[model samples]
Target chain A: MEPGMISLAGGNPDLAGLPLDALGDAASALIREHGTEVLQYSTGAGIDELRTELTRVMARAGIEADPADLLVTAGSQMALELITAMYCDPGDVVLAEGPSYVGAISTFMGLEAEVSHVPCDADGIVPDALEARIAELRAAGKRVKLLYTIPNFNNPSGITLAADRRPRIAEICREAGIVLVEDDPYGLVRFEGETVPAIRAADPSVIYLGSLSKIFSPGIRIGWVLAPREVRDRLQLLSESTTIHASTLSQHLALTYLRDFDWSGHLDRAIVRYRERAEALLEALPSALPAGSTWTRPSGGFFVWATLPEGASADELFALAAEEGVVFIPGSGFYADGQGERELRFSFSLESPERIREGMTRLARASERYARR
Target chain B: MEPGMISLAGGNPDLAGLPLDALGDAASALIREHGTEVLQYSTGAGIDELRTELTRVMARAGIEADPADLLVTAGSQMALELITAMYCDPGDVVLAEGPSYVGAISTFMGLEAEVSHVPCDADGIVPDALEARIAELRAAGKRVKLLYTIPNFNNPSGITLAADRRPRIAEICREAGIVLVEDDPYGLVRFEGETVPAIRAADPSVIYLGSLSKIFSPGIRIGWVLAPREVRDRLQLLSESTTIHASTLSQHLALTYLRDFDWSGHLDRAIVRYRERAEALLEALPSALPAGSTWTRPSGGFFVWATLPEGASADELFALAAEEGVVFIPGSGFYADGQGERELRFSFSLESPERIREGMTRLARASERYARR
Candidate 1:
């Protein structure tokens, strides 16, 4: 199917939200000044300029980090894979949120790690539940290698971890001596919430992932990892044997963009725009959803998670909605056990308010038809 | 140490040889046309236009391939890792030349694969030694997964496989039901010799790896794999879970560079420049080399392989040469068993003729000091 034939299935930024002109200027300047070195093989760690910029960015988030602690990867996905390879042996236990990012689940599974789930609430993974799961796994004699989380505006769930819960969660993992893999691709996205401290700030053992794809562009594939020196060295060595380094040209261009442009202002505009479209979806949901349906009102980021009447299959709804000229990802695909049959996730990030209204209208018709049947 | 402190230690392109002006123009055009998309997350299979262009390029090398059979990776290094993960199980036997690309060797080792070496001559891996090694492993009931080779202008050896050996090597792998991974980063670099058909042409099971770094730019981190459909699909899945894809910005820029620019002409200039540098290094060798020391006269690529006198350590020589303001990679680092202690690899690609001569002179003095010790 054509990618544009969708309202909620795609994980893309609103095209209108990107700072196109600023990026164009940055690219031009990058080529004009550093074209030669930018086109050559760089150090495996990353371009130093980008690293330094990212360090300052992390500092603003309350995480005390240095360029030496960072290894700019192709994306957060690569960071996850490299971490898995470095930490998990075959049959190692990897714990994650019950309904997590499909990419993260797939990455750990591909490395042959046994992925176990920790149930999450409206405010992200339940700290007590996660601790219990870790305890149970230890009692069963399984070595838990790491716990993966997306604390800020997580995929599928679209829920942020509460500020109060962050430290307790970090403390639990630290006490258990398990590394926390914190993937925060959407932390900067502020539709209607106060910023919270990162898990890395609460615990130095946390391996934090950040991406330019969510706030800027997904195509560039620039992401980074902030971790301890030991973990950083292992990731660097593994990356040296993999891609060698993130694209030098991309790094240079990104560094130029960060330096020469007002990124905070750009992100503010993006947040305002996305919030407007998200509000449009929320306003239309009452008439569109079937009886006994419930959905989370996300404060920020891209998705709205919806649950249908009991026994109403999200996969079936997806097919019916597609036939009615709307599309959404079935929530079951996001679960580790593939059991979210009655749920669906709608993304308002890529569509405008008018298109989202049209999509939800079609979705309402499909839901009415399915309920009648 | 500063990257080009002396000479040959790094895998760098000759700055003077790079098509700097053309690259700058290409970068400018790329940003002007696709700045937003370049900064976004790209498809896991890679940018389609770049894949199509690479398909045509591979065809010119006599490997009849489709874009579907190609996967644009971060670099040839990522290709090696993906292939290793796709085909190898722990304890699998992976065969390669005794002295091979250390990066490839390290990747397989990281996967816990038992690496067995096949001896090589000046013209690359000896067919008889390869067959014997395969026979010994098979007799021992070991499952041989793949034979990794750099058939054209191999690293650390600076030797190209003879034209007649291609089919013979292919047939042996075919009959043994083992896959052949043909990594040819330096294949397009023909300084003086006629080009030979790739082993992929002789056997359908052979996997071919190509890089744009040597010819265009390494900073982009664009390389590709041409393999069977099954293997290609597996790599695609692995890539999906790995970095997601190579950098979208780099891929788009590379496509623009290949499609809108004169890549063939650029390559022609690179070959000419490398040839002149290679000749200069060859001419300077006589005055610098000790009696009993010898070097390979490479037809193409960046490195010149030199064997010092028996009982002389290349490690000691490297240290002495560095003291004298010359640097080269001690050849033992390239070997699997640390047996190439008497050899050194001098890269002629990144240095000027004058620098090459000066470096060789320093190396000669170091060699005499080591010989006496």
Candidate 2:
């Protein structure tokens, strides 16, 4: 972005909300107490403390997995790549929601896998639609390797998978013998939604990816996959040959922060803070957006998906958006087949309430200018 | 390894040899001074300070590259993978030294690229042989993609390419239009060898990989690649989508440490420490090993590559050595085609002098046992 542009594109954590003092205290304590181990090369999955903590955290989301089954990654993206590599050979069909996280889509394509999107409504993935699509793909003799999803607060759409659909989708994948990757990076970030049982809890076969990036810190680049032993073994081998495990200092920092920091207190504060910002965006949307524009009423998470007027594509207005000094991810960038032509995702992760309002006002003027043209 | 077993297998910085105190100071200072920015999502190629520092360090090796040409990675392994991904399509031929790092081999194979071996001698890859092989492959209608070589203290083989041959190989590679990957992770770890110009110094087209793992610390997983703008751009995209920029905290830690720490002084201590360990292993080898065994006299880096007696296989003695409570990597593990049958690599990086001597004696006994059979 240019110096004066207002960025509503990035889905990063709250910059001002980062626990600076706690992290410093943790770092100092960790280095003073376990400096050698933290700084030296580490082996065998990762630091045990981080893995164990992830397991406990997963339990809060209704996921029960042995710490032994979890493998640490550079981030959930690495875990996604690992799973993509392990399951699909090139050209094998991998499924995801219609508009998925661009990063995941990139990983699937980067590994040369064919990504086929299953359409979704407001409440995340529609189970019937997913089952029908799976059956249709099977009938067409396409090998559906895995189903990738961001069920809780899905990245761009900001829609939580309906509570009832979770188990049904799990059953469908299990019966179809297709692996499900439940990437729930934004699960614990919610402020108003009720916690739903994870697909992993419904079916132990699902590969669950969790990250501290959304909640704790992305700077650490720490995330983990709760996968079956076979998948875990493959990921471990890939890791051993690639990054050779997550940054040891990061694993140490995360573990120390997890153990010593007030996690619940920090998360509670985040929920209240994000909720206020989200509300501000939600409240401003109706007035600031053009009449035909519609967006999700997301209870939590980083973004709110907005659909522009019927014939107006976000791609066409991107230049105008830049001219108006507003920046957000164009919806077409999120699509697998370039289908999100009339949509854009506005991230509410970074800016304060007033800044978010100001950005939305700029976006509104950009939209008006596009409409006039 | 078992509790009582002595290991001469690990190719890592010594546990006690790491600069923990300096790193701790850096971490504390960074988090205190620049917490939010350090913790926030960083844009661009990498931490600017680290990239600039890499520039000065590369200059020390008689190589000149702008910071823009550099892309920091999780490790040199990731740099290798990124280069492999950027240059070669699946089934494209990637040539490597006969006994290159197994990690690189795995990465190439994992990406479904065809890996072919070019034989090397005590002074690293024979320039004439490399030229001949490229011609043979090109004549056979094989698409010669890249030549991957660890010219500085080559892993597993411990052979540095002779200074005079560096320019020759560079010229040959340039003439063949085959890009060269000069992995120099261990360049700064040198203790005894005269400083030699990097192959990249001769050919700016070469993609040079350097790591702080051997010299600074491995646990941070900091490595970088200096390449042309196009290759660097691809790496940037991969980094953006994959691990999300090599752990922002690690990058910050590295940048801060580079600016604040007594880097050269720390490197000097590391050299003296590793040299002592290498000397200890080198001195014990002649007396402890059976006649006919010869090892490369590595002036620097971790491993001492030992060639077993002709017609005898190190694979045959591995079990005996395990029973004898001594551990080292078998040479076959490093080979692409399992051609290092009558060889083994003894890493003198982890263990102390007395411990290394003890392990060597056990290896001698195990060798004597295997040779007797």
Candidate 3:
């Protein structure tokens, strides 16, 4: 980016409050003590200790996962890819939110799987709408094999799947024989909301993806999948064949961080900062966006999804925002069918509260200039 | 394995001679100094400095790689998978050596691609046979998309393609319109032998895979592919969609290892240890195996591929060896068609010289017992 540009485009985690120096010392100690094993190729299923620890991490999210059923992946992104590759054939329909995680959408596209969007409300995927979409696809003779969902604090749109709707969606998919993939990267990163029990907590068959990227560190690239016995078997083979396993060094570092460090304390402190930044963006959105424009007010997670006033183009606004020396993702990039032309996704994760406020001010000027034009 | 059992199955690098303490300090200092950047997500193409350093690494193997044409992958295993996914459709034939890397074969099978074996001799893949096999497959109206070759010290076979045949094989593949994937994880791990130019050096169309796993550390899981521009773009997209990127910390660690450390010096010391282990295994094999049994005398890398005497069952030998407290990979596992019932692979990279000799003694007793049975 050019100098002085305030980027609201990337959803990268804030690294300022992390225990970098201490973690560095821990990294040194781990490698020094366990260099031989950590530096060697591990079992294709992943190291036993990391998987055992991951069960505790999942337990905190209200899901009881067996270490035997868990497979450590490069990230939850890889888990998504593995599931899609294993189940979705070419032209197989995968149902996801209308505006879903761009990375998940790209994974489906890369594997030649057809993605169909299920409409979502503020509380997340409406149960009836999800059922209706599945039925419609079945009626069209399309095989709906998977329902990909970001159940908690979804990317681009920080809407959480309401706790009441969780089991309902899981049941709908179970009855429909469609695999339900609950991606919960931000489930544990909540600031003020009551903890929502994962859909997987009620359904054993649901494949749950959990990541430490939001809470611990993404640089380590550790994420895992908890699946049914048979699916876990297939995923292990897929993971072994492709990347063999996630980086052993990264996994060991994560293990050391989780094992020895005050990880929860670090996360609590980071959440405070994230909440403050979210408030700054939410506070600015009302006056910054034009009248009739609307946006999500997330209690936690990274983004606020804002829709431009009817007939205003987010694409044009994006260009104007660039000239104003700020940047954000145009919402169309998040959709499979380019239907979010008048929408924008503003991320508050990377910037400080002050920078976010200044960025919003610049965005307001750009919006006014766009409206005038 | 049970206590006292010798394992010659794993092709793990010997970490005994590695600078563990210094590396630990380096890891600490690197994370301390560059925590924020190293702890964040990197570009899909990988960090620029790592790729730039990779060119120098590849240059040592006589391949001039443009950083623009390189995509950093989790391992060469991933590079093979991406190429297979990009080019090979289901039922498309991928030609590989008769005894090939098990990981590569598994990758092809996982993606539903058909693997066809081209018969190999001690000098590695015979150019004439490779051409003949392609001609026969073409005549049979099969779609042959790729030729996967481990040109430098093959995993199970311990064979390197003769320098003179490299260009010929490249030409044949080019004429056959096949993508030649040169997987050279062990290229830089050479203990002795003239440095043969990579097939990719002669033909830029060939996709060259290089890994730091064999030379630096597999724990970090860093590898790269130098492909033609179009293929590199596809690989970058494939990589981005799945793992998103290799671990940022691992990449930064690799960059630091290359930039600040005498990595070549470390490899030299590792080579000495490897040479000692290989020599021990080779010396023991002559007296350990029955007369008429033969094995390749590898100049570098891991493994010594041995063919049991006529009518001997390596599977039976393996069982006996297990009882006698030793383990080896049966050769059939390395073959696509299950044609190597009377062969075995003994990896010398993991065990010390003393352990390798003891393991060979146990293997000889097993062989004699199997022959008696």
Candidate 4:
């Protein structure tokens, strides 16, 4: 174990690779050009320019949308919160993948909604299992309010839903009259494979969530939700009641960057950097793991989820790894039904290849010590 | 009818008065000095530097609070929404002044909480009426969950609560175990008289809301909630579910502005400007308004609430005013129940004294036209 820990715990992008100069220039230029208009309150829908750009951002995923169909939020998290506030009452059931983003689960729980995990496979949530769960929840007289999924490069899993199944998933949700919330914060971070059609492409009524957190800067906290008119109006009201609007200066900064910078070229550079980090961790894993240990080989995105030996507790491993100066998320935190006890999630988002290699070596040593215990 | 209309309907600050150059410099300096750290995700409590600065900002109000006791929110609007979400359940009662801020009533209603207006006089919500309303609500088996008030320089009323009555309001809430949300966005913008003590001074447990929007800029969306440890933690969770944190870049910009700018001098100038505008509106009112129309003589803040002649309709006057090329909020919009029909709220925040005089003349013409109808 190394004395200084290499944390693979957070899903934060590497600041070294970010377009810092461009962001700074954008903010400065916006304030200079617009004067105090950049410093005033915004319409709850956010600044018009940013929302127009967001439609273009969404169009990249093959989802056709207009500015009127979208509402700017504090981040994609607020988009999720607002959707729940708009649709679900307390005790309403929210079906999500068994192993998913912990933050979303926490958000639903905070809203007093009951989150029930549907079974998931290597290619997102299993369709048949999802359909069965919906029927079971309905049979019990529970209101199935929403079906939330990160169809592309899902957090913790780093797995994208197979493109062929996108329509089926949407159909299932629509048939049940449950709104499907497609949270796609990490979709644009793909290092390999062609861009898959968004679930919103399959169903235009889908509340599609998008963010600049992965590609641009999370500090700006700019994210948008594209939905039907009625849903979009409620989302705007939620923004009004909560944030009023995302920071007006942040929105203008986003607008300036979109208008003036080559974001696509910047994204290409980010992809190259992340792809290298992912490969380094993937290559080191086999040498580090004990027999029967297995992990996903992601083609894109931040995480590489690993399954430990049967009956091995990820919580116990997390404690030991921290003492040994290496850190990752214990996968139990992502599940609503106390599953994922023998799994861990490692993120290669912020770390360099050299740092990831050292962190994996430390993880290997920690596993050996725990196995002996 | 005048050819050029003047808008007194909005609550937006004057662009000419905003510290654009200083704000721009602050933003540029922050990004230049900190690099991408200013462009990253934040903890739910927000950045420490901003919260520390916020504590210093609050100290001027006689609030001796630690940064740990404060949670930085997207804005004071987010603070109000979080308080309602945290304390109230469906069907819970939220009591406020008869003519309070419209935004807040919408927020409580959006959360499915019933908003009821407590009786009010010029000196804000009458303490005796407040205590009686709480008792009445409790007697009816209703949960009197929150007492939401703007303690000084209220939004629609433009009236500060009497100094002696502040303690009584807090005591009433404390005895009933109801949360008191002290929304003080415009308190620090006082252009005349002494700064009154906060209702939070009488009870430290009060969830006091403060914003930089009134004295600084709203574009940054910087606001903070000062509460007890348990309440602060819950507010952080709500922040987590909503905006994640106030924009990290905005936080740094605010910190830089606080650290380097001559804020006291800036505020002094703002006070002087606002006082002139307020006086202009007051001076013009007698000649511009019809007989038996009375208005508040607020010592500070943006609003001047006026009552029209008996049975006069503010909405009817509003329609005529729009036709005559002048505008103000019909007081009906401010009340939770259908009341305040013969009242109007005129803001002196956005226009100059010269423009205000012309607008008042237009309003006078509108009133005469409506009276004949």
Inter-residue clash pairs, candidate 1: A217-B40, A218-B40, A218-B41, A219-B40, A219-B41, A220-B39, A220-B40
lDDT for A286 (candidate 3): 91
As for candidate 4, its clashing pairs are: none
Top-scoring candidate (TM-score)? 3
User: How does each model score on TM-score?
Assistant: 0.97, 0.96, 0.99, 0.98
**Candidate 1, fnat value?**
0.70
lDDT of 3 by residue, A79-177 (tens): 999899999889999999978999999999878899898999999999998988898999999999999999888997999999999889999999999
Q: Summing lDDT over every window of 10 consecutive residues in candidate 4 chain B, give the lowest-scoring window.
A: B13-22
- What is the C-alpha lDDT profile of model 4 across A221-305, one tens digit per residue? 9998999998899789878888889999888888877777888888889889999999999999887765588988787889999
Q: How far is candidate 1 from the true structure (C-alpha RMSD, Å)?
A: 1.7
lDDT of 2 by residue, B268-355 (tens): 8878888888998999899666688899998888988888788877877778888888988888867767689988888888888888
| Docking quality category of candidate 1 according to DockQ thresholds | medium
Superposed on all Cα atoms, model 2 deviates from the true structure by an RMSD in Å of: 2.0
In candidate 3, position A205 carries an lDDT of 90
Best-matching candidate per DockQ: 3
Worst 10 residues of 4 chain A by lDDT: A17-26
lDDT of each: 0.84, 0.84, 0.89, 0.85
Q: Which stretches of candidate 4 lie over 4 Å from their true place?
A: A1-3, B1-3
How close is each model in CA RMSD to the real structure?
1.7, 2.0, 1.0, 1.8
- Report fnat for all candidates as fractions from 0 to 1: 0.70, 0.75, 0.85, 0.73
DockQ, candidate 3, vs. native dimer: 0.85
Per-residue CA lDDT of model 3 for B106-151, tens digit only, reads 8888778889999788788888888889989989999999999999
Worst 10 residues of 2 chain A by lDDT: A14-23
Q: What TM value does chain A in model 3 reach?
A: 0.98
